[model samples]
Target: MKSMKSVVPHLSFCVFLLCGNCLAAPPSPEALDACMRGWADQNLFSGTVLAAQDGQVLLHNAYGMADYNAPIANTCDTRFRIGSLTKGFTALAVLQLEEQGRLRTSDRLATVMPDYPHADTITLDMLLNHRSGIVDHTTLPDFQTVRRTSPCALARTIETFQSLPLDFTPGTQFKYSNSNYILLGHIIESVTRKPYADVIQRQILEPLGMHGTGFEYYRRPIPNMALDHTLENGSIRRAQDRVMQNAHASGALYSTAHDLYLWDRAFRTGRLVKEKMRQKILSCDAEYRYGWATTEMFDRKILAHSGETEGFCSTIIRFVDDDACLIVLSNLEGCSMGRIIQSLSALLFDRPYQLPKKAPTGPQASADYGAYVGRYQIKPGFFIDVTTQDGQLYRQATGQSRLQLHPESKDTFFVTEADARITFEYGGEGQVARLVLHQGNRDFPGDRL
Candidate 1:
């Protein structure tokens, strides 16, 4: 890898400390600070950043305001809702039980969650690996309203989803679903005869010395906790708090940068689980392994996860073999967390990444819009259909209502309904080959189908 001196002349002095390549020195603290400060100034990042290598802290800093209303500046100890990052911890608890011969990943869901719909067909492994085929009940109607207004019971939550059929055949494919971890949390309680919070605390949290992290309760008051805010239509507003039980082990937990750093060390060194179980958590046998998504970025094997609730977003990526990690927690909604982490990763590896820029406006006129009219399969169960009606172009997803695609550039389209942008790509023959959907700071690629 080369330095950014040539491409990004301004960041020539911002060299990063990294592993794998020894010719260059580790990224300086100044570099990380400068990178984060730049992002904070642009509203692209807030909350915290913790980066380390070989068990050494390289960067641990907080930026932006935890409560912009009072304008309390965030600190390293600021607690932010970790959202789905909690799944990795939940997965570890289950693996701990498995190591004790109390439960097996191969256990049939029916054996534990007898009342759950289609329990006979889904296995524990399916849930862990996100191949359970259960519909993510979170996306169902009234889920948001009900959760925001009341404390949701696990049993009641399960009942609401039980009437719904499986999303697909169990173990046949992968589609990440929070419903899986929620059920796993229930199963943990059944097997250990303890609350999910108690089980997780004893099994992982307390053991790892993570005192600043635990289950988040909607009704509870947490000291120094970051308030979640959403940026909408160019206005920032408070986001409603949802029931913790609604998210359960799937997305309800919260943590600070320091405590999460302790967790990373414990997880990476096998102090928390057996090497085999650790491998299952940190490496991929499928699109998702246990609780983490397996990915390759710049040819580096990385195990990572991202989380988003109403007013917050988070991501933790670990390059275990390279002894590196990036944990970002933000209390601001629609903050470009995806792009922030990607930029940080690029800096860590000396790759070229752009700074925040104004969104590209739509082209003055539409040309050959008909070329993008087709169905695209983003993944096994996800899709986007681009179609034209009369003289206008539109996009639709499986089981979703059609949305109009406002042309930005000739080959680019933006969706205002949920703040997404799509840029179509062409192949050698000059026809549409793929499209990348940019939303929530991450990119999803859909191929012509």
Candidate 2:
């Protein structure tokens, strides 16, 4: 291993062959402050960043105000919607029930909910993996149509899908549908014979002493909570007010940076899920896993997830071996704040933290596009079909409808709706041999199939 500084102006490859070859360039405290301040000043990041390594805090800071109109500044204690990060908590509750013999991961959905139409084929593992083939009941046309003026209660939402068959066979593919977690929540309610809130309270919140975390709707007043915001035509507006309708399990939990840190600590050290179950939660799927998506950095395993809604964006990164984590929560949507936090964390750890390279636009290659237009294996038994329409790439896996992808480069494209991306790694054979799915700060290699 050798450390070679770039002597050439911009053309570069200062190769380092080993972990020790990478030197730590810890950002000075003052430099970090200036960096964050610059971000806020330019409206690049208006959120909180907390990073810890080797059980020591390198940086923990909040920028801007909790509410733009009010003078109250954002602080480490200000709560923000954790969004899909809520799924991790729900997964833990299910594991707890499993430990109690209330259920098993192999239990069929039909056993739990006799009325669920496709329950006969859907298993607990299917639900956790989002492969139940159950329709994203939340996205049915009638959902947004009839749901416009009337808000259905959680139980009613679950009941609406009782007669609907699955979209495909269970455990055959990966599709990110909120319907799975919502059903998981219903299972929790059914088994405990208690409200979802109470179950979460006893199993996770109370046990973790996360006194400041809970599910709250848009209109409710959350103490020390930051109001979600969105950049609208160059102005920042409070943005967390849209009705969640029946999406609680999908994205409605809120918590402060500190509570999330506690949750992360519990997760990494197995204070929550047992060791084996923790591995399941962090494993990657054909697309994603039970809760977190496993990734690799310098060959080290990493588990990560991100949450987003109308006005909030949140991300959690856990270094499996290091017992370290990074949690970033923002009130604004469509900002580079999350990437900035990731870069900062990578900088602190002396890890590669480059931002998603901006996508080349307007034109695309003929052979380049065609080579990537086939299915590739991301995880065992799963694949992503790369297709192009009018030169834009769209990714569709088994049991999922195609969704357009935003290109970061010819070889790399990211799904803007969530923190997921695909990168093509060329082989010595002069062919696109492998594709890497980058999510939650971890990269999963997908060989061409």
Candidate 3:
């Protein structure tokens, strides 16, 4: 069996079929205890879980504290900032406009916002698919510092990033830019002639009965809200410095698992989005949907999305066929919620097929390793350093200290820390020329220095 040979043994084709159909034998208490304890020891997770299959709630558990200072135990009702999951709502709002014949996906950006940079070349579909070459405003210099001091108005923020030249022409490739959805938010406002909050409420929340969902940054009082925390310089501190730049379509919205479960049910039953529109939303850009990042797992269509803000992190995963879903939310910056959810999916559906073992090709050619070592400018301000340590390649971001680069094959290395990865593009000189960082819907291009 591959399990005996490979470090990551690929599950056998037969095992894959059997495991997908395996009845929900609740994970043994002992196993769950060991896993949780191990994670706590390493501080890998400190949040909540809501898992369901076939519309049956399998498990709903909360961990850690809503207020770490007072150490108030978190409950299922505790609200956490759901970051970009708000994009799904934004996408739904645009689709609702489509339903009303107010907008079409094929509509050109110039028609909606004539003043928008490169409006003539970009399209609404590009906004939905994140193929629009608009530079992500969040990637601007001192964005985090600005976000900490005061909430940036949407127009100023969009203009700040819009001034930079586009990374590429529209409709060329995927680059997950928060600016895309933020623009959608602006479109929603422009078309409806109202604030984003009003449009979201009238279109999605009120209809779906998602009473708890809102874009209340400074207006609405957050109840049971988890303060964002981060471990920096070896001490854990509240991430109060990074301002919440009116996330609009990027990262705004506080929701509980219960409300999110309602959303899941609504999506499956075709309540929030019409059946045809839902299919379109789910099927469009199959590899990279409007708001959701997609992949085939265990031969089932898996739709997923993740969010990150100053101090909060969250992830949502759904299996379209079986309606299996998992949602994880945290109040800490840089939390690996996405990795945890993927691991959980592996546990539940028996995934991450273990590949057959092969002997390490000792001491890869120096030239081969040299091709991956270079600086990659992900956006303008963000850069990644791919270097080899102890023979394996590692990825290091500008502000982050840890180095994690997971091997995808031989030349490709996936960032184990975030939902981003780097693939070195070699030129004829046999040296790394361009490095592409693939972050769902967004791609970063960097030239070798």
Candidate 4:
């Protein structure tokens, strides 16, 4: 999975706010529309959004173009490849199967896939909560080439990473790995003697009337589907295609905001799974449950998840106790779903919020840019490259497209295309020695490499 650079920081806070008794009324439709319009006008957002409270729709709208090449406008019904948001559905499928007595969360992986490496040590519950030690297949070195090639058979896909060393001992650590869900998908198929897509279609989509949703596959014509796009060097362009089958249960589903709202409603009404299973899905015992992450925002409990794939980004935030939810589905990759979701949450709760504004354009030239032109290590395998191209400053994270940085101040630079800011720090020797990334209300410090 591509690191949701801006969203991961917020997941770390997980603040449990107690505001049930003091919950604010939902924002007016006009206010919410205006807020989204501001983001669309600033090119910070492009897609569909839906917000609701206490089972009442507060706002549902679409913004910007669905297909820039075709000049097609986005509509509330336009479907987007929802990326990792599909994991929630996959989790739901697993829980539903358990409810049917076909499986149990406590079952060992060996019970389903006996030959899988370390299968005896991992449990379904561990995979459900992302405590499985399986390395994320998407992070493997050959994943890029694999995704571009013809879809591999499920067994082949499993074989590619099945023997790789575990990232950690099973159930001993929490690491988000798409391989867990892929394995779950395989197990589901094994138990039911059916394909994963067929099981999901029969079990969830049909029951909830989510007619606009289905598995995304190569060469399939999905009506009203929005073509994914990405921000490249400050310009929006079409993203390369991936064989969605490779994403499998991890991220192969496509749906509309309305369809996703139906999904949220299903959880609220306990339509698919019983109350006990629902609680298991939302339990905060593990920071992540099933496929959703449990976090606290605005003094209310939140069941949320963010999704990112080639050129699509999506997020769903559920204020569960309040029966309130927010869904954003975008075709443009690198759009700051975290910032947009935070602002919308603030507006929904009647808290102070600011609509996006044009990013400040500082002096066109800065001689100091030379000092910041080096790679900085954020983590063992992640680094940010600050470089100059034709006098413009740019920043690129490992394995990500470069984005131009506009000077916000002498030591601070901001990315106009994303809700990200960077500040260069000087060492005792007066040399630029480190950089800090500011996004999603958190700061990530990186040392010069």
Residue-by-residue lDDT tens digits, candidate 3, 39-113: 444444567777778888766777766777887877888888887788888887888899889989889999999
Among all windows of 10 consecutive residues in model 1, the one with the lowest summed lDDT is: 1-10
Q: After superposition, how far is residue 142 of candidate 2 from its true place, in Å?
A: 4.2
Alpha-carbon lDDT, every model: 0.76, 0.69, 0.68, 0.83
lDDT of 2 by residue, 7-34 (tens): 1111112112234433435655664565
Clash-forming residue pairs, model 4:
17-299
Deviation of model 4 at 74, angstroms: 0.9
Q: Name the candidate, 1 or 2, with the larger TM-score value.
A: 1
TM-score of each: 0.76, 0.71, 0.72, 0.89
1 or 3, greater by lDDT: 1
* Candidate 4, residue 31: lDDT: 80
User: Which pairs clash (backbone N, Cα, C closer than 3 Å) in model 2?
Assistant: 295-442, 296-443
Candidates sorted on lDDT, descending: 4, 1, 2, 3
When 2 and 3 are scored with lDDT, the better candidate is: 2
* Tens digits of lDDT, candidate 1, 1-449: 01000111112122333335323223767777777776687555678999887778889999988988898988999999888888889988999999999999998988887876788888999998888888777777767557545788887777777778788999999877777887898999999999999998999888888988988876789888999876543345677666655688888899998888888888877898889988776555465787777766667887778787767778888886788888888887666665567667776876765444433355433457789989999899989999887666788888554766776666887754344779999999989998998864567899998
Candidate 4, which segments miss by more than 4 Å at Cα?
Answer: 1-26, 360-363, 366-372, 375-382, 424-436, 440-449
Model 4, range 1-449, lDDT digits (tens) per residue? 35231224434432223344434335999888887887888777789999999888889999988998889999999999888888899999999999999999999999998888898999999988889888877777777666545687777778878999998999999888888888888999999999999999999999999999999877879999998788765577888777776778888899999999999998998999999988876665567888888878777988888888777899999997778899999988877677678768887888765554466546577676899999999999999999997788899999878888887778998876666789999999999999999875678999998
